[model samples]
Target: MLLGYRASEQYNSYYKPVYYRLAESGGQERLRELLSQTPSIQIYDTIESQLSELAKINNPQRQLTPEEYKVEVARYLDGKDPDEYGVWVYYPWSQKLVHLLDEEEFVQVRTSRNLYKIKPEELETLKTKKLGIIGLSVGQSIAMTIATERICGELYLADFDTVELCNMNRLSNCNVYNLGASKAVITAQKIAELDPFLKVTCFTDGITADNIDTFLGTGSSQLNILIEECDSIDVKILSRVKARAKGIPVVMDTNDRGMLDVERFDLEPERPLFHGNLNEEGIDLTKLKDLTSQEKLPMLDAMVNLSALSDRMKYSLSEMGKTINTWPQLASSVVLGGAMVTDTCRRILLSETTSSGRYYIDFKELIK
Candidate 1:
């Protein structure tokens, strides 16, 4: 009964949020009418909490008594209609209505905790940037972390696969309920719930040679950076090829021992893809698509530095197609990879770190 679901209405279509400004003419009447007709409506209001936080920001010198707080609130409103203040957001998927400050105020109070860590100017700059993420399994962590940080204004998510029981192990955002849903859709919905103001575009069919140009952007609105995490050997290499052509930086985390790759294609236009790992193995990029699964192992090995991998990983690789059905990944590593990639991408966007190389953040080596 949620949102009067029909067989024809796809779940992906409900990820967007509807907004109503009570200050606008007839806004309250429209919302009241809808609520009256709807059998189930969950309303939440947190505007007062937001106002208290705003008051603190303005009057950091001293605390306010309850009476003084009311005065401060009145001063802040300045005779504006209380019901008309802020914006009302309705989520169709959950049938939940939430009231909160508008985009500018919401962002300021929501991200106030990150003040010294992320300067105001830097956050403003980041809000104007766009990032594209491929392969939503481990990429989920990266995308969520970026969203929590309010790092970018828009996100482009691409993944051709759907959620499966096996993916729940490392994909924290996925659960049994989403087993049959598209990975990109799940991620987009989670992001919308977290911050409806942020923009999210889903590539349900995932990225391919056909749409790579549009994914990387062909016009003035190209992606600022590309996060490559797809499983396909072809896409892993192909994305970098297209990214390099557009002078967009690319970052990847192998989700093993914190192996991170940063390719500053924007800076080094001619840098070898994957730090030339394939070239070292004498593998030809042109013939990569022709290689069988078994034949592609060498390239994959080179891409992740197989010899340097932990003993358990090497053992897992040997057991693939035998003991285990596919490459093994742990929740801890995948989450760490998300954090690692998020931080790397943030720095890349802010120009804090500029280099092209493969680095390892092996826990065993660092913790000990």
Candidate 2:
């Protein structure tokens, strides 16, 4: 009976098009209001509407199945010459759609614009570039950001850590079922599900000095950018050195007290500050790696006597009981850092003049 009533209501709704049309016409404004009241609904409707429009345009003849619609969308967006092969549709904001060379361009237009504010030419550039990300915790956020841009042709993910229950707060790919799974694998799976053509290489062992060469030196042409979100200072320094050697820029993100710090190490052989001035005499990287978590805490505490480093340790020890676990710090740092990194990457890829030096964002300032 409920089904019959629903059917009848639908029929009546079709007949009374004016009311439905009026409601639908004002839906965008109502959606803005609903977003404030119920955020999830806004997210759902926004993604659904855009995807639905994408489906309609891709399959105007209404012959393609839902799965086919997704495939067609991916193909259209990722294709080399989207305008030449497919129909070009104009979005509301920009005047960039010149031709429908292929399916990939459609995907590029849909995902990039939805995820970030990127110009048309910049979107095109993203399709041809490659990115390497070390550390999958915050790296997952970076991947999601890059995937949304649809700019990168391939993504190299390196992480040794597996997902834990505590990681759900920050790592997008980590969940109940995925606990104990290697972060790189889970992140690669997520990216594959989003866009099957997104070429991904996962290294479950994490990036190390020995294996770093193989990971980055795939001989598949030049890498456009490298993102370092690894926990080890040694790995971070090594990555910068390798990028500098290869003439590729490196971007790193850090978070402190809800504020983000972005550092861009552009390709320069004579870069002044190599690794943010570490007191090499106090701590040996090899010895530090072998120390237990508890032992490592005091060692780290003693190694870097800087007030900022000590303050961070004090806050962490007070909250987590001095094991020096990296999860909380990583979680807080990675997301905000990923956003800043993504924005910086966009600006760089677009050939826009962006501040390449260190940048800091204090959320408290915004509250003031």
Candidate 3:
């Protein structure tokens, strides 16, 4: 999986980063062996730069010269083995070795500006919460945004599909190079590159009745908030049902007209799925799994409020199998939806927002 030289994936090693602590026994030797074996390894060590920034943060009044900054970095290490100063992260897929400050310092320097906006206490508390995101087209953006913000300590990603050329139109984390990789794997790798400390669990097979219980969690392993963005009609209804039963909040983004829907199943256990969009008589949610994509169009329309769709979206929907192969999704809408959903989730997780209803951030309407 490392660029051109493919190693037999007996251990699925490409998706994870291997950490090397030179001070530990055999760590230095192992790292050296890895470097020697990989002919096209890319080395990236910015520990000195990070140390300089750390010094500035610690002593804002002092402006150190070049030589003084060097001294400051050495002083910071303070006799600690320079090789063991920070973590050496080896990303298998890209065959890149990255040097980063350990978790505490890395987070401090990485999220220093967010201190007041997120609040030091809130950021710490947010690390204890667990969130799950289903689907990866728009969910990829949501996951990347959440990871970049360090909004959750643990994240669960479920996507049954692989990256395709068409997905790159909206999936920012994917590219032509990794066209056949699992969406969940691609997202997880991206998150790892951002913050190796954050725990991520991937359901590459996507969620089904079999793994639903485990994904949503049971007892102490439950998710604090659930974000559903899958294209499956059955999953949309089924996940809500499960989340409602567990009193977990569910948030979603339609990537159309900036629609963000929140269902606080935790607040109201009796809340109807999709805000009662599927509650009408003769529409059986249980049978949705048995229907084809074309057959499920009516339910999809009702759930998304066909009448309220933007004129362009409505027309696009009408041309799903005619003029267009599927619903059109631009990169702009997907990115905006990611931000909208992340903000809503942060607010909900921090007890800053509790209302459950559909909200629109339609730029055309707002700007006018």
User: What TM-score goes with each of the models?
Assistant: 0.93, 0.63, 0.92
In what order do the candidates fall by TM-score, top score first?
1, 3, 2
Cα shift from native, residue 117, model 2 (Å): 3.9
**Which scores higher on lDDT, 1 or 3?**
3
lDDT of 1 at 338: 86
Q: Which candidate order results from sorting by lDDT in descending order? A: 3, 1, 2
| Model 2, C-alpha of 75: deviation from truth (Å) | 18
lDDT of 1 by residue, 1-368 (tens): 76775422345556678898998898999899879877698999977777878887768788888888888878777898766779999887678899988898888888889897989899999999999999999899899989988889999999998888988988898766677778898898889888989999999899877888888886668999999988989888889888998999999999888899999999999888778767634646667789998888777876788888899998998898888988888989988988888888888889999988899999998998
Q: What TM-score does candidate 2 get on C-alpha atoms?
A: 0.63
Top candidate, metric lDDT: 3
The alpha-carbon deviation from the true structure for residue 278 of candidate 3, after best TM-score superposition, in angstroms, is 1.8
Worst 10 residues of 3 by lDDT: 6-15
Stretches of candidate 1 off by over 4 Å are: 1-10, 280-290
- Greater TM-score among 2 and 3 belongs to 3
